[model samples]
Target: MMSDRLFVYGTLMRGYDHPMARLLSSNAEFLGTASIPGRLYLMRHYPALVPSEDPDEHVHGEVFRLHRVDEVLAQLDDYEGCGPSDQRSEYRREISQVTLDGGTELDAFVYYFNWDVARLPRIVSGRFQPEAFSG
Candidate 1:
């Protein structure tokens, strides 16, 4: 069985408040923190990741080696509102190069935002820190 890998940067990252975090942790090997070149955004409730060409911008996240990719992704696809037939979904799954904390790089699946972020606020820290909504 081939093990698939995924990199989650937002709610899916361990220690977040999202319930999906537990599901992912139980089904995959927690490979520790990793980062990739991108810009993070606050898109209402959750954060969105947009590709960045800037070398200085590295989006922080976690890496997981999945033993049951097909099953895991199917569940994640629903949570992320992504699928093979959903072109209108807010996020789209794509393969990206992620660098581990120690500098090891690996190709992993990532969910990229599909909508326009022109007016969205950029998360300057590159880390998605979840907080309670003041509203």
Candidate 2:
């Protein structure tokens, strides 16, 4: 997979009322909405994506064709609490296949949560909208 693409959910998704969303939108090409097989959890104020073994479950998000992978990833790593060599990083970047609205699939970089999910609430809808959960 090329380093120029990313699959972002939660705060990074467009219209999510977050700084990271605005930052990414201004610098990356918004490919469109997409989904991958995963489970979304309400991790406090943000969200976490964990790969799901169930084929029917999906995590709704957006896909972007990034122009500056290094720069963008650097900022994202900080926001995600991830480090280049730290095993304690909250998230780990990995490549996964995401299916677009019209069923086109593409490999993109996804930040998978690295912590335990014993208590996180599962988003049954497989989608996370800021307005829906924000107080």
Candidate 3:
């Protein structure tokens, strides 16, 4: 299939303004609020979602439909130390069902970090407000 639009909800969020937005070039479409149905924790200044069975806990993040998938994916792969051959690395791009606050569902690529939670430094929980992929 052709490269599809993607959604990011963590570090890519605004305020944090990580470095992923530059490659995107144009502004992304803010679909709405989204949740991954898991517990999000801060790991070494970064936020990560830990899949949980609990229904009360949810990973809150915004939804952005990213364009220019081809170029964006390339830069993302490089930053995550992943390529065609390597799947297991610092982060893995995954298609997860992220739901918006209003219950809108969509297909998006979430970069789930591959680092061990215990090994990585843990930051204060509920620190980063995941509302935008760009500042």
Candidate 4:
């Protein structure tokens, strides 16, 4: 079954002033903070998440219940550069298991990096620090 939940760990997370973040807040219901087993890497102004098998690795983020799944995902897909029109997308959206703050595990759609990250610095803390990009 398809899940209407989405997990955002980068600029789409709450408290971000990005237009896409605002759009997400207006179009979906914020469930709560959640985490998934993954490694985070700095991709210039944003962060990218790569699935990890190491239990110690985790990427913290927030989960949202989509009010209009198709519409919202369409916009998010385009913004993430993985929409159908994007021939060489840098990310791919997929359903992954996430653990909420209360320990509830559920499937949620997540955008993961689709390119090589060998040279990128890893966000060891698992949290994306937006301030690091602020000039």
Candidate 5:
């Protein structure tokens, strides 16, 4: 079955003033904080999630239940640079299991980095800090 939940780990997360973030807040219900097995890498002003096998490695973020799935996802797809028209997308939306703070696990859509992360600096904390991008 298709899932209406989405896990956002970067600019799209709450507390950010990004327009897309606002779009998300207005269209989805914030479930709560969650974590997924992955490593976060700083990609300029934003961060990227790279799946990790290490049990200790996890990326922290928030999960949301999309009220208008198709509409919201369509805009998010373009914002994430993974829309159908994007010949070389930077991220790919995939379904993954995320564990909420309350210990509930659910399938959610995650936008994962599609390129090599070899040269990027990994966010060892597994959390994206916007201040890291400050000049």
Candidate 6:
């Protein structure tokens, strides 16, 4: 099976310094750290991505190759309250180009949250860090 690759910049990183680390396995490949040319900020237990008005702002995270994507995607859907069917859920899974720390960009599927439905303040301005996101 082709491995399901994803980009995880916050808690899902290897050292898993984030509490939600429990939500995933440590064996997942920590391909490398990367930054999207956008502004990122702390939210409860996760980071929030918003369109960067500034051309130079960045969002830091790592790329991961998931073993069984269907299962993981289902779990992620539950976690994000996507209902395994809701297209309007905050976190939407999509494929996009992600760049590594050294500037090498790769294609991967990432679960991104729609800030509007998140019902939380823009992280860059709020600076709220939580171990879990329940909303």
TM-score of each: 0.92, 0.94, 0.72, 0.95, 0.95, 0.69
Q: Which stretches of model 2 miss by more than 4 angstroms?
A: none
Candidate 4 Cα outliers beyond 4 Å, as residue runs:
84-87
TM-score, cand. 3 vs. native: 0.72
- Candidate achieving higher lDDT, 3 or 5: 5
Q: Where does candidate 6 have its weakest 10-residue lDDT segment?
A: 125-134
Across 1-135, the per-residue lDDT of candidate 1 in tens digits comes to 233899998888888656789899889999989999999999987899999999999899999998789998999999999967778898999888899999998889999999999999888888887774336
lDDT of each: 0.89, 0.89, 0.61, 0.93, 0.93, 0.62
Q: State the lDDT of candidate 4 residue by residue for 1-135, as single tens digits.
A: 688999999999999889999999999999999999999999988999999999999999999999999999999998998855564699999899999999999999999998899999899999998897678
| Best candidate, TM-score | 5
lDDT of 6 by residue, 97-132 (tens): 778878788887666666563465454532223544
User: Which consecutive 10 residues in model 2 have the weakest lDDT in total?
Assistant: 9-18
Assess the local accuracy of residue 29 in candidate 2 as a C-alpha lDDT between 0 and 100. Answer: 95
For model 4, give the RMSD to the true fold.
Answer: 1.5
Give the distance in Å from residue 77's predicted Cα in candidate 4 to where it truly belongs.
0.3
* lDDT string, candidate 3, 16-129, tens digits: 545765444354666776777555556544576655577666667666766666676888778655556575576677777777778777777766766567654332342355
Model 4 TM-score on a 0 to 1 scale: 0.95
Query: Model 5, stretches more than 4 Å misplaced?
Result: 84-87
| Alpha carbon deviation, residue 56, candidate 4 (Å) | 0.4
In model 4, the worst 10-residue window by lDDT is 80-89
* Each prediction's RMSD to truth: 2.0, 1.2, 4.5, 1.5, 1.4, 4.6
Q: Ranking under TM-score, best-scoring first?
A: 5, 4, 2, 1, 3, 6
